[model samples]
Target: MPNVIEALQPTLEGAAMRAVFALPQPLRRLIAGPPIRIDDQELALDAQLLLKLQKLTGQTGLSAETAAKARAGMARATKITAGSPVPGVVVAERSIPTDDGDLPARLYRPREVTETGPLLVFYHGGGWVIGDLDSHDDLCRFLAKHAGIRVLSVDYRLAPEYPFPAALDDALAAYHYAVDNAADLGSSSDAIAVGGDSAGGNLAAAVALRTTRAGEQKPVFQLLLYPAVDATRRRRSRELFGNGFLLTDHDMTWFMEQYSPQESTLADPRLSVLLADDHSDLPTAYVVTCGFDPLRDEGEAYAKALSDAGVPVVARRFPDLIHGFANIRPVGHRFEEALFEIVGTVRAALELHKG
Candidate 1:
């Protein structure tokens, strides 16, 4: 009976979440407390409720725990939030050849492919400390199913175990592996893109810049979801929405500390991609930021930097959403809607690139 209840947990949670989201916006806002307005942006009703639920349940963050424990906690949380895998997307276990042992990877392929179509090499976001392929599984599936593009989800080494340059180097290695094997992956070399949320987003941006300057195969596109572009400085968002917004500044500091313990390593452009000297002629990019996220300003700043550098970039801000919304789409109707919109944007961008 216990096992059965455990198995039915996601279903139960899903139903409850759906019921909450089904409520009228005003009701949700009322339940989540009065409208939360900051920086001239009002929090969306759904986002407010989600945060309220988290706070009520004492489910803020796991920053104070050991890396091992935090990782385990993250996995359990992913199970509840990921909901169910979408149908029609084929998932396969694969390995990315890297010097630091073969990294585990999951390839998400749409039922049909053009062989020369776009393929996004994705890194799961956990501030480079906690998340894994499983945490971002549903996201990969949705991207593949909705955008009609293949997704290569890489499980790069985490921090405090494999610090700073380790993840970045491994990410580059995985991207190189993808480039060399794009044909076998049912995608062309020119159609491959790099993407991730938060830490993963930081990796994608770094990888793109590295490949561009290092005379390697350049990626054609980038899909950065609230990337942590500059960890060196704090922007207004950090102070405004630092607490009760799902991703707290305390957690952010802890994550970065775990990723790069050595104080000297903080200034490296690979860790803070926004500090990189150049950002021109890299790849077409779609950068998504959340209005209530601490990392929002840094992400937008990076997007602006990319645009000023003459790169074709689209920067979208979900004014009512909070950070890490993509991973919680299962029960979050508003998040699901925003995600689909992002998928459509990706599809259109890829189509135009192919033209």
Candidate 2:
């Protein structure tokens, strides 16, 4: 039956993915290289893979249809190249009903977690436009397995269709859902966290701010990975690393236009979280930034803001890497190292909660 086939798809795909990664590491490198250098930063081996991807998907322009198709192809390629799922991580697909609609989500749990534990409600990054649950599936699985925490990847509505508060709404909805139904999702309600990379990071920060303001049960921790905290993009890093990096200023402009067509809304705290009046009382945060990301300064600025507000904050910046480096598989040991560091941070944060 179609339903049976649909249900079996992830298993089949995951198995195939594992086999592909089982090949010799040298061979994998050969397939994904040779690396290119841009400015002072040497591009990762995955840059070649991205070039091939660009050829396959064309320019991706500003159109929704082109972007969607390109995103799908990129996700497929990422899965093939992302090595394999972390061993002993169990994945399941589920739909959480929101006031807007039934929001699809994927849940990842470590095999050791037979009882309730920490839960990370994650939003996938695509500049609020071009990502979904599948796009960041491998990262979620890696975090869940390595950090020994449950990860719920939400498929929030994308922009040029939903726009602005829509994605924010879905993100907040998912976080609340996790808080309310933590037991059902195999997590302790008190140990819930919210995190995301890039635009999803923006959403996570916004949700954390709003939750604190609402006098609600706030998330225990915040994990912001290269979040786009400033919609204005006026920082020196934006000009310094705006081009040649994996994400260009042109692409960022396109994404911004799609997400917030009105220039007036660009300064709104929900969109530009760094512009928020008060950062006091936010949860402890782990903020990651890449040297070659245009959004790097804003992310650091946010961390500084949180620290100034007396919120415990851990901020790490990778000087040799570009935007989206943490999610790319073909980037070699550097990528693995960065990812492991992130997972370790998550583990430590959860353990503190347990204590």
Candidate 3:
């Protein structure tokens, strides 16, 4: 990974292309105190985020250790700018026992809860290498508050250290724990769902598949936000948006290397849900994809697979945004709108299950 200065020092051709693709909002924000909103267009924050990320990456590089620090720092900054916590949501820390050890968890409960509210087991995204409960705390709070559902954010073990089956094991264990102990968490076991973004999204989908294969009680729903369904990275999106977007193809490869170094593991359904033999009889899915994200094609593909297998699925794409836009508050109203859309979908899905 290039340093901040090195990364931002693009070649003449690349610089020219960037200038052509850059949006005026980010440029305006650079000069002025706030972003100048023009017409509603896609790539609204592309230039802004891209520039910020380039500087951060340039300073920190993409080494595992540095990336972890950078991610932590960014999460802290995001929290500061995330404004106040959503009202009517109660948050509590939890320790969920897994086969390996005790996994840290955070429970977000809506104030207006009934005897049987829906529970969403959420996993945070960090390419299975970075991220934790803190990174996604705000998003979870918003979901719990606006979606009117309880959210259990699992802090699964990351890669290089734990690797492959570890995170998956943790995810599955957390799901089962939520199901068996749902009542204790003030949610109904039958109304439980699984959700996550990126690598976390992959884990959520894998858990759903594993549950289906085991003939266990399937989750009521699966909410995948820009999930990496294909570990093989064969999707065309990898080549298209793999460069300038927040998550690069190189970053994806780095993550895969850290998580599953062995090429043989690529085909494992737990690692690559898209390669699973059966997608039928899982659960209803709400898949979100970003047009500029390298994982977009695979996420959409997974959604299509679910729909083909007779599962009720809703796939929505935000053409203007990049990967991880949901967590970046600086992206402006588009981020809030997208987050609300996601929460709305979760609410509607849970309601349908209740009905």
Candidate 4:
């Protein structure tokens, strides 16, 4: 088995392009953060990769500092199609009521909007601290356009202020509101699904469990992008890939600290669905993992648990990808291929539920 660093090197092709074979780890860390060694591949730490991220940031014609600042206030990520635009599938902004206040959300509909297209509720990744709709905008638009589905990007409250059940509550509320108001949004109430990347994915899974417990129909399927399903921070993967990846043990600890008001909530099943008593009644799932991420093992573990409990679960590990590669769709061929594969998976999953 290779180390985490080895697993992540390839994903840095553009950055490491034409580089020497034996550069020191520290230099790489300064340039690209850390990589987790798993089997033969290496995974880059998400934050560092994004910070050192070159092409997408440049192509978007936005400075990293400026883009990061704008992201602080937004909710869901998004992008629009060009050339022969769809008549009605404009990316629009709106808010849904939560117990505390209005939770911001983005709606993406394609042209020829069916009075009831399947809807996907999306959450952005930021370790519960940094991301917003602006960060993930491109991916959501791609999914909506490619899958012929409606995508609602949720901007739930972040940590250090809202914390824990606050975000969870917001996610649940947004979901129900979307379902109840599906017609107004021009989507089928019965076709709603929930999903997110990293922390958002964890929230989506928890929402699915809570919704089922409350006797609501589970979302059609969960589309989890390398979700952080366990908060314990004790898994071997955590220890192994903990330091070098863009998400280090320190960073995750920071995120957990910010997101959980009480330290004990780290063990709460709502925060760590992998610790839940049963995953049997949850919706079908498509869980994606990165070979080099610290959360890789736990994501796979949750998928296995779901499968073992008789829930239909499909898992994919992108051996050559890093944690936030899903957000960098326009950068590399690998991202484009992965993006299409993701949409195809959702399309297939939704079709099954429809039948």
- The best candidate in terms of lDDT: 1
Instruction: After superposing candidate 2 on the true structure, give the runs of residues whose Cα lies further than 4 Å from its correct spot.
Output: 1-65
Supply candidate 2's per-residue lDDT for 288. 97
TM-score of each predicted structure versus truth: 0.95, 0.85, 0.85, 0.79
What ranking of all candidate models by TM-score puts the best one first? 1, 3, 2, 4
lDDT of 4 by residue, 1-355 (tens): 4676554434444344324212454764666645545678754333334445433333221112333442432221222111123244569898998769998889997765656778999987877777777677777878888888889999899876778888889888989998899888877778899999998999899899899877986687889999998887577777766654456676677677778858788889988998989888789999999876788899999999999999999999887666666776654455668779988999999988899
lDDT of candidate 4 at residue 285, scale 0 to 100: 96
**Candidate 3 local accuracy as lDDT?**
0.80
Regions of model 1 farther than 4 Å from truth: 1-14, 24-26
Candidate 1 lDDT, 107-185, residue by residue in tens: 9988876566889999889989898888899999999999999999999998898898999999999999889998999
Per-residue CA lDDT of candidate 2, range 208-316, in tens?
Answer: 9999989998999999999998886588888887765667788788888888999999999999988889999999999999876788889999999999999999999
Quote model 2's TM-score. 0.85
What is the RMSD, in Å, between candidate 4 and the native fold over all Cα?
9.1
Q: What total of clashing residue pairs does each candidate reach? A: 0, 0, 4, 24
Candidates in order have lDDT scores of 0.89, 0.81, 0.80, 0.74
Q: For residues 1-355, what per-residue lDDT tens digits would candidate 3 score against the true structure?
A: 5576553433332444345334476554563234323224346554344445455535322334455664665554454335456778889999999779999999998877756688999999988888889878888988898898899999999877888989999999999999999899988778889999999999999999999889998899999999999887667777877775668877888888888989999989999999899999999999999877788889999999999999899999887777887776433566788888889888988898889
Model 3 regions more than 4 Å off: 1-41, 46-81
